[model samples]
Target: MLKKNTQHEKVSHRKPVVLMSMGAQERKGHDYQVMTVKYIKPLAEHAGCVPLLAPTCCGSEDIEQYLSMVDGVYLTGAGSNIDPALYGQENLTPDKQQDPNRDNFDIPLIHAALKMGLPIFAICRGMQELNVALGGDLHQKLYAEPNMLDHREDGDESVDEQYADAHQVRLVSNSWLSKLLEAEEIPVNSLHGQSIKTLGAGVQVLAHAEDGAIEAIHLPEVEQFTLGVQWHPEWKAAQNPNSIKIFAAFGDACRLQVQARS
Candidate 1:
């Protein structure tokens, strides 16, 4: 038997764990919490992190605990729209889908995550949640707003077609996204009806669509990585260089958090 050379082998570093907020859904008669594989794949493959789905159907009391268990937070897009009342507006789109349990849980979770300085990557509806959580408002019906382009995905299109590049978003000069993508502008997919109407207290615009809708944002004041995009970067992320950059940056930030805790 050979003796183990433990002295020469370095201890392996653990991958960062990301707490991902999930959507509330109903299948048949029972209500359930769900998270799509699309969101999980990039976090695991590109970000090199363990994906932990946090159920928003549950109460928000565990947000602090959830924060303690992970190095980063991921807020994924959902099929439902946020309740307009959150930003002090009446429910103008009452006919649109809404998930009250998810709304109640995720808002407090975003607050808690920010308070802890945890890196957050919010997408689509997740971006809206982050905005509302920070005192910003959204255009309940973006297309309805004069001069704004329709950003919603075509309902009858296949998944791949819907996630295909819809338009170009001009990156803010010298912003983090522009630096990462190494370009002034890039093509992006669009699949949302609401968009930022007012900038959040500390949220800085990172990119914009041709029609002037906010395409990307980040907290310039935050030390940790904080980003939100109106597009679904997680869709076919491995195949997109821009999406790869976004996930890679987020992964690096998460790993740094792991090192800090160690």
Candidate 2:
């Protein structure tokens, strides 16, 4: 533990802890970007869960120790890509920044959380990570891949403008998301170039981009919540009713799990 989160300490006894992932900030001398306040705070505020930053350079015992303290896990989008070798593929480009550290940490954390039946909410790189961790594979670069939409946007646009509803995501009929949102389709902010290529075992494809990119996934066998989306909902969660609903459901599931343990 780098430092106890003072905010969480105030009311963590009442709120369920959601262990959130952060990108490995390797620049400016190495250190863990365990969790971003922008990403983690929303889970605490809107979702009604206590956010805890899970470090990326810990051993299995350290991970298991922390996993015992939290009620759920939240995996965030990262600037770096997952090392392709984990999923039996080679990187198509040498220019990509890869995170073996995060891969080593998160994959085990995800599996341990899954085994514990903890609620999980994932986004973007986290979503892809969920796939690879569960014996699935990914397309290195969708731009070079045939018959897929160029999911990347103009790099020069401000983050706000870039994430402003680029496309619509159609919900799968009779899926968990369809029942939750009760909407046929919803617009989402797209900001990634890579996408899931193969469906993972025990994973359900819950939504898709108009061009057929896998937009969302759900694991049905989990005792509690398990959902992952390719687009970012945390960017403007308060404004998006669907994002609010999703987080709320996850938070509720986490609470229920906590009550069951007690």
Candidate 3:
């Protein structure tokens, strides 16, 4: 009988590669595409995945190529807002920062990624982008709306305080998100001036704030894990059970994609 060398035998398990969309920034006479460390850390720590940054400074002509190499897509919150023109709306907040380059790249990227059945987790501005890509419009100034609560964080507060839990969001009964988190309501940080005014096609509301602002959404049409949240769950995700579960779920879906491809 031959003795099996179990110690020397190696089994390989590939980590899912998530294509993280970058925001365009210009500084010191140079143009740069960047994503915050806050968003990146959670994917590496909680999600158990590799992060691949996709540049939006350059147009998304090569989006298909970028998608081909990754198992999932992660759209993160950005300092800039999406261009209103994409969703048939005139420039309502022209003074606010808008990234047309990112707009051009992410919209097509969203459509193509969906076509390829990639799991997507979008946050803040990314959520707005997803809504616009799906034919939805934003309030532009959510605080200005009648009876709407102001969702923006005070600029004077420290970063940690700004990202702290600001309000509670009521999760829809029998929602996938509610089931995953095992909670009917969860406290979330609020730091945006705009909110979804009109829902996009196939977009289903998952959670809402006390003021009725849409806090989270999901696409029921996509069999893969597709979720968009207005809050910044990536901020100190390890400290929060809800954030950990959300990222872990996304990571699991990406791993399944990796398995399918293999």
Candidate 4:
């Protein structure tokens, strides 16, 4: 059983806690909520921080308790679209896979983390949520947009296998993302249908696709490191130099957050 820890433990002795989102599980037989711990752990450890598996299915008691204990948050990629209700639209197409439970969990968490100015690294769906939570919008379907290539390849969505690099994103000059990557443009694997349409308040566009789709975002006003990218850096970080640099930068940010608390 996952018990909620009530107190905020000592900071100096604490590990740098990263709150990652988890998915709903299927029951094998007995009562157990099975969820796979995805991207953040191995990559985080490589960057020198401990990763905590923070599930979105937890009750309010668990959510509040865990958020209070963590040092930082990592909003990971999701397979479903952000509920259209979140952006004041009705569900145009039904996606049964959507998890309202997880959506509800993350919305408030994003706001709370922003309020506290915690360092946040959002990838793919996480990036989209950050924008929506800040009053921005998303392109419901990328391929529908004129001149936009298929953002996601047909028939295969998983990132574990070898795939062709579909497109390149041009980083804005002198932008935080460009500086971090030290490059003008980079090849990225696109596996998302929804993307940033209008950037949120205080959020700056850091990178864009050749088709003008928003690829990366940052909040310059926020003191802490807050960035969102459209690609899955965790999967590509193993071999791609640019992806590796991006993760290394995030890890560095996590380290700094850990140091400040200590």
Candidate 5:
């Protein structure tokens, strides 16, 4: 039985720590943590959850400590590709853009979260990481995969906006994702080159792209909210009601977990 807390009465008092990958970017000969912080934080707040930022790389502090401290985990998106070695696959092409620090942080954190049955919400690269962490594999390059649409499309080279409704994902009936969104199909912004190849142990496919790419994954056995989507829900959630429900459902699940533990 999980111990419950009584002091934190308000939902805002329940801080859900979000584990996000840090991107290393060099500017004026200085390394900096450049990431999409503007997008996720507000949406999390809107969902009635306090977003606690968890660093990708840390010392000695095991994930269990972080998991025990927070109500839920949000795996944010990133640009780096998962190392092929982790999945026992040969590198078709070396992705020099990979961040080893984030990889080390995410792998252990993922393992700990799964073992402890913590609620997790993953997006884009985070979704891929969750799948890989659960003994799944990735396509490595989506373009290389025959008949797949071009997923990573920004509006323009100079523009900062991603392509809106560039693709559509069909949700499986009677799936947790479908039940959460209360819909059959959802339009989403795609910005990923890698995708789930083989699902991990105990993971279920919730949605799929028109070309048969895995768009969403969920694990029902754990009785925890662990869901991953290939598209960027944070970007859509700001304006789309269904997207808002997605995050809200995740937040609610975390809240329930906290209440149960308490």
Candidate 6:
């Protein structure tokens, strides 16, 4: 359990603590990027949760304690790719980099979250982790599909330009995402190279790309808030109403979790 707010009396009220799965960068001195300051802004201001950076490459038994300390879990975009063997396939991207540490962290957290009925929000590679963790498969290279669209943006463009709306994703009618965005379709910025080829058990396709690739998914059987998006909503959560809704709903779930735990 979280320590009661021992700070200012005016701010003694405890906020829901949400764990963020940090990505490791060996090139950057093998440091973990768990302190995603930019990404945590909307989560704190809009989601109303205290975002905590979690240590990756830990034991499965440690996951229980970590989950016990937090109200929710958030998996973010990573620089490394999950091993193809995770889904019963060989490494298709032999030339690319892989992060077994990230996979080890994501897979266990996702499964434990499901068993604990904890709220979860995954983005980009995080979504792929959720799929694979739940017995789904990946397309490996979405660009290879003649009928599918490339989800990445221009590399030459500036950061803001690259993160601009890449395409429209149509939401499934009556899906949780459709209700959150209050629209049949939503414009999202894309930067993922791979996409989900098959959905996992208890997972529902919530949104799709123009070429019909899986762009978003959710745990239909889960009563807690669980959502995964192909795009990076954290890029503009405070500015985008669509992004705001996602975090806000997640925040509400975390608050409820805290309350239940208390």
**Which candidate number maximizes lDDT?**
3
Residue-level lDDT tens digits of model 5 in 1-262? 1223344455445555555445556689986765676556644655667665565545425666767777777787776777888898987768446766676778778778777777888888888888888898988878688898777765464223574677789999977778778889988777887889999888889999999999998888787788888887787467777778888888787778677765
How do the residues 1-262 of candidate 3 rate in per-residue lDDT, one tens digit apiece?
Answer: 1234442232125789999988878899998888899999999999999999987776878999999999999999998988777778788888888888888899999999999999999999988888888999999899999999999999999999999999999999988899999999999999999999999999989999999999999899889899999999999998999999999999999989887876
**TM-score of decoy 5:** 0.88
Q: Which sections of candidate 2 miss by over 4 Å?
A: 1-13
Clashing pairs in 5: 3-261, 4-261, 4-262, 5-262
- Put down candidate 1 lDDT per residue, 31-80, tens digits, no spaces: 88899999999999999999988887668888899899999999999999
TM-score of 4: 0.86
Model 6: runs farther than 4 Å from truth? Answer: 1-13, 28-35
lDDT of 4 by residue, 1-262 (tens): 1232323334444556777767554566643333334476445644556776776666444666676766677888866788888888777658535767777877888888888767888888889889988988888877788898778756655545434477889999987778877888988887788888888888888889999999999899988888899987776356777767776776677766766766
Q: Against the hidden reference, what TM-scores do the models get?
A: 0.95, 0.92, 0.95, 0.86, 0.88, 0.91
Per-residue lDDT over 1-262 for candidate 2, one digit per residue giving the tens place of the 0 to 100 score: 4255664544444678888765667657867565666687679767899888866765445788888999999999987899988899988856977777789888998899999889899999999999999999998888777777788878999978998999999999877798899887999999897899997888889999998999999898777789999998888788889989988888998888667665
Candidate 3 Cα lDDT to native: 0.91
What's the CA error at residue 106 for candidate 1, in Å? Answer: 1.3
RMSD each, Å: 2.7, 5.3, 2.7, 5.8, 3.7, 3.6
Cα-based lDDT at residue 215, candidate 1: 89
Question: Which lDDT values do the candidates have, in the order given?
Answer: 0.90, 0.85, 0.91, 0.75, 0.75, 0.84
Cα lDDT of model 6 overall?
A: 0.84
What is the C-alpha lDDT profile of model 6 across 141-247, one tens digit per residue?
A: 99888988888778899989989999999999987678778899989998878899988888889999999988899887888988998988999677889988898
lDDT of 4: 0.75
Query: What's the number of clashes in each of the models?
Result: 0, 0, 0, 0, 4, 0
Supply candidate 3's per-residue lDDT for 169: 99
Model 1 residue-pair collision total: 0
